[model samples]
Target: MASNLPAPEGVEIQEQPTAGAWGEWNPTEDSVRPVRGKHRVAKQRGGLARSSTVLGVGVIAAVGASGIATAQDRPQVTISLPSLPDLMTGGDSGHGGAGDNGRQTDGGSDAEAGTAVRTGVIPRQSDHRADAGEVLRNRILQQAESQQGAAEAQARAEAERTAREAAAQEAKDKVEAARKAAEAAAAEAAAKAEQEAKEAREAAEAKAEQERLAQQSGSYSLPTSAYTLTSHYGDSGSMWSSGHHTGLDFAAPTGTPAKAVAAGKITSAGWSGAYGYRIVLELEDGTEVWYCHLSSMSVTSGSVAPGETIGRVGATGNVTGPHLHLEVRKGGSTIDPLAWLESKGLNV
Candidate 1:
């Protein structure tokens, strides 16, 4: 015979009875067994509730493991069943499976069952979820910092490149300006040098001309040796046929020597129109000199050398006293003899 006996802790335990010890088993009697009290009903309900709660915890653990496996590169994880704590305890069975305290009839209260589930499973799952959340937050922050650093480095490099270009451009401009200034200075120097050279050449030419004039004054002599200058040419007078005096006068005693003024030919040695004797000498350049009012003529019509005696002074024709009248003619015109001699560099 098989007997369903309630154990000491309200758990049902089945036993095999020896043959013939109990009568033939009746299934209807077992099904229709009468409940003794409310404690027995409450004990049965509590046991079923506790089993269901344990099953629920296993399902939750499996879900947590699946979530963790999908979040990382790892092998698929196995769902392990949670170990359930024992709900029953040994007690005296003389009081029909109840403890000495009446409160123990329902095996254990709802509060104790809930405590076992939480202590074994809920705390471990909460800790795993918190760790996963922290790792994700840290990774996101590191990526943001790295990207910001790269952007700042690129901006600094670009700024340096722009500065270098500006500096190079400024240097080039300065070089160009300096080059132009140098060229301008050189051009000014060349112009100044050229002007100085021109001035020096003009001054040299003037000095040479002065030296040439000094050399020409040493070659001429006067016609008479000693005489007093009584009259000058171009003097206004009525003592002669013309209205003006046409010759220079040298007054001296009779028989004074008269010399040739330069090397020339004697064009005439005697003259009669002035009521006296006269002599005329022709120079090499066709300039003629007249020696009038002469007491005697020494040279005739021939070439005479300079400083040679030509005649003697006397109070002869065209003269009011013993004086020599000297006339100079060139190209049929009479000019100032003193002025003509000075032009030839003679200090007359």
Candidate 2:
């Protein structure tokens, strides 16, 4: 049997059996030939069919669980009907229906409902702080306006006070000035009264002195007989060199008797130069009397008598016609005869 077998060429043979404690001859290819489709179909039908049924059942169960979960996630709400009084009032009431149900019943769609829900979120506390800050700013501005008004009022009051004070001072000044003027007027009136009184006293004294002088001079008689004055002393005319007649001239008819003016001694009875026939008489108290332009002399020199005939009126040297020139002298100076005669109680 070994001689008739061929030589082993690409054949693989085990040298010894595995350590399973059993040694067995390898089976030939004819005994382990590849079976056709029937056996594989039988094997698959036994185990794979049962496993596919289990997997299908698990998938259906998962789909059912997902649908149940989706149903559970949908929004659910409960709504209680409002009370009759709340429904009639129409305004917001605590007993109103649930917010979601009210919105839906009031015709709010899903999108509007979502917007209203988002708007209902509570505002931050910081937003309230901002509002409060705005209110504080407005209050501060109002206070500033009030303060400004008060300041203006105070300024006006001050201005009025100043004006009043100025008016008061002006009135005071006017009163003071009036008082001073009144005092000045009174002083001027007093001074004027004093001056008038002084003038009156002086006038009275002068009158008294004049009366005493007249009383001391005794009475005298007329100087000429039936003679009229032709020229008075200090009379201006062309007959004299000095433009003034220094002696009184009396005009009478020729041979008119000239009497003594007073009780006096005959100082001279002669034909003087200018006075053709003249007589000079001296009284007791140094008074002198002159008789000029005489026609003739009745008494000689050194004769003394009262109311005695002294000379006769005549046209003599420098005489225009028959006239008597009578003159009176006191202490060798000529005096006004008319005034002297009047002082002696004679209206000559």
Candidate 3:
């Protein structure tokens, strides 16, 4: 700041400057450092820079708030900026002192103002800092809760899907198992039926073969052919010796064939007094069959099968006509010959 005051009465005025005088301002790192958050000024010259940063931010905020209020009421409006000199030199033409209210009178000199920038204007004030901080903290907590809820929902959905899949798999396995079980049961039933059928067929074939052998072997047969039953055992008759008949008589023509009733060996072949020219056939069960009044003997010895011809019918015994008198004896005792033959599956 160059002085325009006149030199005191030409006392060889010097161009050299004296003490406590301002110089041309060139900002340096020592005179001013960059302002960040808080309004701070260097001690080198009583903090002239403090007015710009804090005051500028406060003014911008106030203008912005007024603009919002004006737009709500009507439409957009512009605010003109102050002259650079007025802002820099901290002067308002309407006031007389530069101590306050962004005002200075008659361009007050630096010496009178005491600083290059006025420190009069105060920034907007807030009652407390915790209100803003608390709002931010609440927003953060709400965001965290929302994220956690979303994660829990996703986990529940995944669990439900997994459970459904597992249930479906279990049902499929049960169906497969049931199918296999049904197949096994069917196979077992078929095998059992087949085995039963096979056993039944074998039993039928065996029975048929047995019947065929019974026919071939002549298991039981009548004693003589072309005969009539003339006398029965236990008949009331006076035959001189016992007064009752002891044998059943089968009357036939002379020399008619007399056959063995069952398979046996010939035990006797000679005549007795009353049953003359008789033949005795002893069966395998030890029952003896007597063929009486035979005209001639054929199987007189050794073995003979059932229905084999062993003699011819005759009347050489007692007073009987041409007939076969058959008598059956068991355990050396006599049984009715007709009843014995009937018990052997023969109706004679």
Candidate 4:
């Protein structure tokens, strides 16, 4: 029989009969021990080839797993294969057996695998960290917006509080100002009333004083109407029986009314020797006043008040014209009537 198995490297092929073995085999360790200057075979070529094939298959499987991993990690990815004609154009015709074995290992016919390869497409992987970053950015922006809204609400609240406080303060200020204004007006009114009262009191006092003076000892008035001082008392002239004037002479028209100088009583009235229509008055101070040369006598023997009309003036009692001879006598001695009247607070 022809052997189909290849020989190991550094060893010759020979037909050898073995008593215990049933087929051709490699040299046993006991029979193939090498001495010096002889090389020992490391591994058979067929075994190396089988190991290489397994490593290639493992690498292809690892690449496919990496592609699957990429598809899982990325979006919008596609997986497709090349066409059979493209694969055949890139491979040697002598590799048909290998391709058939590869097709068998991949669980498909060569045509189907080639067709799948031609149609399959792969896409790039996406970064999952980028999507996570986008989510983080959106969260940050939302947080920022929330914080801004909260801050704005707080600001609005603060503004409202400030406005309320200001309004309250304004009301308080207005009340205070109104109070002060009321106080000022009240004070002004009080002062005006006080001044008016003071003026009224002073006017009343002055009126009372005038009335009192009219009733007191300081009261006096003119004794006659429309009279001129024609002769004074004790004038050195030949108009009297004693050869001198004895009283003051007031000359006037006839029928001029003569009044009492002060409050007195009429002691004597009527005509006398060398004195016509005469009247005499006795005062409270024991003083006497004589009125000679009267046109008429109105008072009888009675008390008289100051400023009362006693008689009228005329040419009587050795007078030159219509005149009055007024005499003041104390203890039957004559005195100047004008001086005596001035001493009694009379403005003659």
- Model 3: weakest 10-residue lDDT segment is 70-79
For 217-287, candidate 4 gives per-residue lDDT tens digits of: 35566778787888888888766888888888888899989889888899999998788889998889898
Q: Whole-model Cα lDDT per candidate? A: 0.62, 0.60, 0.66, 0.65
Better of 1 and 3 by lDDT: 3
Best-fitting candidate, scored by lDDT: 3
Off by over 4 Å in 2: 1-123, 126-146, 149-153, 176-184, 187-226, 233-246, 253-266, 271-277, 282-288, 294-322, 328-348
Model 2: per-residue lDDT, tens digit, 1-348?
011233245321212223455333222343223222111010122233312223323433443556543211222211122222222233222322333223212212222322322233322446556777899999999999999999999999999999999999999999999999999999898888888888888888877756654543444666665667778888988887678776777677898788876677988888887778888988888888888888888887775666688788888878678888777898778887777766765545
Clashes of each: 0, 0, 1, 12
Give the per-residue Cα lDDT of candidate 2 at 341.
Answer: 64
Taking all chains together, the TM-score of candidate 1 against the true structure is 0.44
Model 2 scores a C-alpha lDDT of: 0.60
Model 3 lDDT per residue over 226-344, tens place? 88998898897677377878889898999999998888899889979878898989989798999988889997899998888999998886864788989899888778888877666
lDDT of model 3, residue 329: 92
Tell me the tens digit of each residue's lDDT in model 1 across 1-348.
Answer: 323332335322222234346433332333223222111112223444323323333433444456532111222122111221212222222223333244222233333433443333222344545776888888888888888888888888888888998899999899999999999999888888888877888888877755654554444567676778888889987886788888888888899999887788887777677838988788888988888888999998888876789889898776788988888898878888877766666655
Instruction: Tell me the spans in candidate 4 whose CA falls farther than 4 Å from its real position.
Output: 1-218
- Which consecutive 10 residues in model 2 have the weakest lDDT in total? 35-44
Q: Judge candidate 1 at residue 75 and give its lDDT.
A: 20
State residue 345's C-alpha deviation in candidate 4, in Å: 2.1
